[model samples]
Target: MEVRAQLASVFHLDKCLGCHTCSVVCKNLWTDRKGSEHMWWNNVETRPGTGYPPLWEDQQRHHGGWVLAGGELRLRLGSRPHVLDQLFQPPTLPTLDDQYEPWTYRYGDLLGADPTKDLPTARPVSAITGRPIDPSAGPNWDDDLGGSAVHAAADPNLAALDPDERQALLAFDRLVFFHLPRTCNHCLNPACAAACPSGAIYKRGEDGIVVLAKERCRGWRMCVPACPYKKTFHSWLEGKSEKCIGCYPRLESGDAPACFHACTGRIRYQGVLLYDADAAARAARAPDERLVDAFRDALLDPADPDVAAEAARAGLGEAVLAAARRSPVDRFVRDWELALPLHPEFRTLPMVFYVPPLSPVRAVRSDGARPVSDDLLADPAALRIPIRYLASLFAAGNERVVVDALQALAAVRAHRRARTAGDVTAADAARLLLEAGLDEATADAIHRLTVFPTLRERVVHPPLAREGEADRDPGIQGLVGLRRRVTS
Candidate 1:
């Protein structure tokens, strides 16, 4: 019954076009400073390929996120000695090969070179050191090459697939990939916050935005790998750990985040979610197969009368509750069950959810014929991407949730086709909805919300109930007006 407002987000992966527009705007706005040359707070990673920082999902190497031991939930960092060793030892952290060394062409060499037989060209020089260096890797080096034998072969998701399925995914024409834009999940039970000895990282009480107080940071470097998503970074130049602020300043002004605003695909949705604080632990401890449903049960329906009364007792703002009632995040995640949390086995209870993309289920093509929108995918097993591969990312190795999401997506397409054209039978569309566990009305709403949502429908920022302090304080930056400074 303890209600708290969390500003959660959802990314409809089906709509993402691998454009990287969101990443570019986020970099220009926040991570452009001296200490942040290598930090990409918002990054778009291609699936079936090792993501940024290479093999980040391989927690065996990074030791990020949480694990259940002896029926108790604890951080994967293990004992105190392990934490100290991992934190202090530079070699244990991400090497230059892991996160590519940031480099820029030495334009001075290109422009002001002495006359030569060949046209003068800029040599690649390390951005950190002005010295010339050979460059090989980059953040998105594997973009669109998810089917490459070299890059995709190294994906941790492929480990979930069998040898035969893996070979098919790597084959020339069977290749398919999708974009996965990532940011700090701002998790309910953040391991980064728990792992920080300095207590510099904390989730804000009002909005649930996880923040690292730079003033209290001691350059411990523990929070970097402690973040399962690898969202936290150590600023070598500044001697502090930093991460995405979740664009709180823009949110306070009643505007969506820069990345959300700049997104061309309109794939991002942000809103408040009210959850029982006590249920988070229970949900985290649930069995792997039931973990997703358990987490979904944690969110209290904002429309419930008892929830409103309990929210008032728990100090949830009236405005915050109203936002939750109409939150698109709630509709996608809780109501319709379209969006599911990423890597829930990590047990961080990440608030950000993703609507599994439909690109993996390529329509069946016959001899000398073209694939059409009305035609449904023949079989999940014969899909372009393996279900086990997606299961590893979204369902923690359970294919049922992934299958359900795909079926729902297919039903929507068939439903729309039947309505607009005679290519698909209406009875088949209705039957598809039944198999997908969605009603016609629900499917239509999902269609509008995804394809034709207005700006207001897409973003639902709650009133933080800061009690008017933020507007009054002229010196405020990044919700500094509302929260207290915890100085060590």
Candidate 2:
């Protein structure tokens, strides 16, 4: 039972005003040099739209991280050194375009001098490519235009529409907004370290912060694709993959990482957590309940005399232990009563935990009367809110699909609870689901289903049953009819 110190970050999204002060400070400190100008060791982007690199959510297209197939977790970067060597080999003239094609739009063109300007007169141009831009193809061209999870949660009337109609309404209303700020998760089970051909990427023994040893690096860029968050960057000047060091120099002096210290929103917190390395490794291998249970047990209680004695004996510092006592991860694990890996299905067992935002639904005017939409009742897509994209970035599973499924399950549970009470308010149900760990966007989708009039009728009962039905008939036909009844 060897105890290892881990560096963990706690972000309070409620406090995050989407200010880029943290990003700017970090860029000035680490990424301002040549060959790193385009690199943002830290960045903030609007979510649901493509991230900076565009479609970063499509992991299948990127071929990064582990995949579960045939009941086994398969590492894409081969386990052998030679295999990693081949995988990491540098490319010729490695440019930002290789990783991300920078793009921007012309907003001024749409606001032309003339009020009645049309077609050619209203067209804008691209800033980077310098081509005549199509307003339809530019960055954030549709920013915040689609119906958001927050909107759906606030207004439950949307749930009754069909998926296609709901999508159209979202596109038309432009209701949702999400802020995604990214940095290295510095994972407990880091794929970048595991995929390293030269073992250059190693987790610090003292802090569990995954770091790339510059000199030890073989210049194989496998870490670029191996990272689910895509935080690792290939440095042409250094000819290696580099990432946030968790500001080790700062941490050594009992200071926070640069980004955390500089954050205007106070969204970041640094602390130590005790974990079972052996159990984490085992989780990386089999990836089942035993592994999940292992994580649940590895939680360290700084106040517990026995746990404190064990930590001190394992060489953990008093300062580290002190911080762990008041850390956010400890609070979330022990008090908040919520546990979700950033992306559990990915099997990387990322330690980062996000407490999902519970967005409020608001009343909307419909047809000159206050008619609530049933968006929360049937369609999961009506939740126009955004879940933290970090889950898909660091977690070891099918990040998007798994999160979506979890949201659906939560919605079902909330709906059932509401039905039991005989007072089913789609908005209330959606709020309940949001509180249960579903992101605003997904919760709103469920809310929309619950509120939609047509969808409510469709989903409240099976297609085979009408008004009159016998309660206690035990015949096969009667059982089928009972199953077909719409109780809600």
Candidate 3:
């Protein structure tokens, strides 16, 4: 089966409060140094708006991810010759304007201004140029749907909807948005690693975390657009590509990632997933409609005896398999089938999955007294956030998967409300749960994991065998290899 253990995550979008605590903490920890001012290794993007590095999801323009041509999977960036042709000047690289210019306030101006003058203010200046400039954009400039007319209107996911539906989404009173926090997906088949001409980027075999070795980097900047998610960034000062490392140092010590740990909404869950490595390509090659299911099929159940034997033979430790058995990500993704990957059509096989959010019920006033739903829990189609829109974000234009996830979420809420508020009977809640294809016990378990999981239950780090490794530092290893090459 070619079983391999991979670290994975699940983010419950419904719980995300649009709080930037995750972003701020990730920034303070990883990308705060010079030349990385514009890089947010972790960023929370407001949906229905152009995300950071505007229009990154528009693969037609950026030419990121993979494509199947003549039944053979290949880089969407084109053949090696084409890549070489554009090596010096990649045609699809995002410009500085695309990624907002990082800036800082001129605090000195505020401090040194004449006392007699009117209230002194700090003028905004470019972090790069040290000159005063008008601040026009930021990573989360369109947060809470700010500048919806301009930025939100340009969202690429809107292209999937009909013209009328698109218009309705942009209408002032009808506007609805949600938070999408992002980082490097640490994809199973990372295009960034495949596209790196210098072989600098690599995915760790033990844990599937993609990382760039700075010592071997040649400042090619190829990984930038090669990543469909646009998580890889070029550092102008260091002349090397950088990205989120998944906070391996923290993970090695049995802790969750910085962003996951700092999240105010408790929306993040980290754990290990055991998947059949041989099946990844076939899964990625599946048709758009079946892509999500195909990917799910690639994840092997750790509890399976045959799978465990294969995993052990493949060098996975017992500790890792045990963690994988308790993995909340596995439950959310494979067991309950509630979480789905973002843009499965990208064919990167991202390990991180998201539980599609359930939006507030659309208000239809009756006699102008109050807004209410026709159905008890409100239909998925009647939610403020359209199932089609979420499908575009998560399911590769397949609305059915998104609808199923929302229905399951609704059932959980209904069950909880029935228990706590007594508005609905236990029988009624049971019917809703059955309708959603879940048993009462399963619903209750989902409720506990979603709303009130302990920290241990939230993040389950696998045994990486890092303790016994001799050459732990890549930098030192790189230097040793260089000295040997020169001496030889």
TM-score leaderboard ranking: 3, 1, 2
The residue-by-residue lDDT of candidate 2 on 1-488, one tens digit each, is 54554656545443456667877888899987755644677776554445544444445655456765675666654555545456635332234543443334455666655565355343344434557644332222223433334322222223334454445445535344445566777777676776777789876544555788788997777777677667788766667778987676765554556777677655554455566556555566665434444455656566777876766666555555665665555654433323345444445666555444333222332233332444443333333442223233223322343344435455554666666664567676767566455555654444433234131121111111111322343221111221221111
Cα error, candidate 3, residue 451 (Å): 0.8
Q: Which tens-of-lDDT digit does each residue in 279-298 have in candidate 3? A: 87789898899889889888
TM-score of each: 0.92, 0.62, 0.93
Q: Is candidate 1 or candidate 2 better by lDDT?
A: 1
Clashes of each: 0, 56, 0
lDDT of 1 by residue, 169-264 (tens): 777667788889999999988989988878899887547789888999999888887888899988868989899989988887788899999889
The alpha-carbon deviation from the true structure for residue 422 of candidate 1, after best TM-score superposition, in angstroms, is: 2.4
| Residue 240, model 3, lDDT | 90
The C-alpha lDDT values of all candidates are: 0.81, 0.52, 0.83
Q: Which candidate ranks first by TM-score, i.e. highest? A: 3
The collision pairs in model 3 are none
Highest lDDT among the candidates is held by which one? 3
What RMSD, rounded to one decimal, does every model reach? 3.7, 18.8, 4.6
User: Which pairs, if any, clash in model 1?
Assistant: none
For model 3, state the Cα shift of residue 141 in Å: 0.4
Ranking by lDDT, best first?
3, 1, 2
